[model samples]
Target: MTSDLFDLTGKVAIVTGSSRGIGFAMAQALAEHGAKVVISSRKEDACTEAAKQICDAGGEAIGIPCNIVENDDLDNLVQKTKDAFGKVDILVCNAGISPFFGPATELPDDKFDLIMRANVRANIHLAKLVIPEMKERKDGVIIIISSVAVKKGNNTTAYSISKAAVDQLVRNLAVENSPDNIRVNAIAPGLIKTHFSRVLWENEEALNKRLSKVPMRRIGEPEDIAGVAVMLASKAGNWITGQTFFVDGGDTIDI
Candidate 1:
């Protein structure tokens, strides 16, 4: 079974916010690698479409829509996955929102609350919901989609702060598990060209400014982060836990 190091055959995965962008790419990759994956997001239609793509590719997948901000939705998501797949082997908490973009000092309380609630608090809740089963099996992988903004700093203070807290969250969970078998980690991507980051990469001037700092001299694509998630979820990354893997194209290192 040495060749099975990266093989995910028969594993069940729940990837939140997987209707598009990084989440979709990771789900697709996991499915392709033989894991049964759930395509989930706020929009049922979008989730269905994403799931269809995976199934069409000869992968096992299902669509389950869930608004990550709602605790009930989170519960339903896990329950739905268990109902369909019998067990959860991997969980990707990739859904998040950043409603405001401005000076940290000027950030309004509502937006700050929204940002933290969506990005940080929600992940904690989802983890709480699924970790018990993982602990019982003594095996699991949780990957959080974080951002390089956590390290480089950004004008959008609330979003940046929330991601920083996520890195710490991964650390805390990984440490508490202490090589017990449930691995919790994160992926910190930089300047990816997706609808979610259009403001930073859409304009010629803005894109060039950000690209100049990246040693790779290019922005990342959703696929760029997908491979890392696959490795982490597979046995190849069993030894690694509670660390933030930077897929930043040298953005964090250049500085």
Candidate 2:
């Protein structure tokens, strides 16, 4: 039936950077929709807390601390998920870093490298590591969490470039994996109200300036992105692939 198309029962999902904020919200949403979720982050304590919150909500989740910047950590995370569950049915490459906030000229080279490694390289690494297993099974879904800044050419030059790379990564992977029945997509969110974007949303003057561009006339919540993530990971999106969905509350449209 139509309702069953979105059902995710028995599926196993791994959401990186899921200790809190958008990642946690997406993990919770997947769990609520009947998927076993792995909540991972750099801090074990934060991961544990997120797992507990999901469990309390009557969903199955396990905390696994993983620093995406480290390949060994990512390998351990994949191994632990296979050991704990059976397989990884879904992967949300949401772990990213944005340490700098100025123009590209003023941004430090080290910081720029950090952003490239964490936001762009890590996502490709994780996807490549998981592809063999998914190919063997001939089924899987990979979702990359991108930013609307890529489209708007935001002031965070390094971050925007990295995210744009992620968008292309999704497209390339989707093309490569489509014949194998694996789907890959990216979600570019606008100004979502989260700790990650607190500096932008918290400032009254900046918040109003940002809001004026969005026809929605408000900021987005983690839940807003979470729902879309659920849709992409479930059977409802089986026919969808190679797309960069802009969940920007009309910000991209206005600009």
**Who wins the lDDT comparison?**
2
Q: Which stretches of candidate 2 lie over 4 Å from their true place?
A: none
Q: Report the C-alpha lDDT of model 1 over 1-255, residue by residue, as the tens digit.
A: 678888999899999999999999999999999999999999999999999999999999999999998999999999999999998999999998888988888999999998999999999998998888998889889999899888876788999999999999999999987466999999998877788998877689978987888899998999999999999999999799989999988989855
- Per-candidate local distance difference test: 0.91, 0.92
Worst window of 10 by summed lDDT in candidate 1: 173-182
Residue-by-residue lDDT tens digits, candidate 2, 1-255: 797877899999999999998999999999999999999999999999999999999999999999999989999999999999989999999988899988778999899999999998888888888899999999999999999888775679999999999889999999999899899999999989988999998889989998998999899999999989999999889899999999978888955
Error of 1 at 76 (Å): 0.3
For model 1 the local lDDT of residue 213 reads 80
For candidate 1, what is the TM-score? 0.97
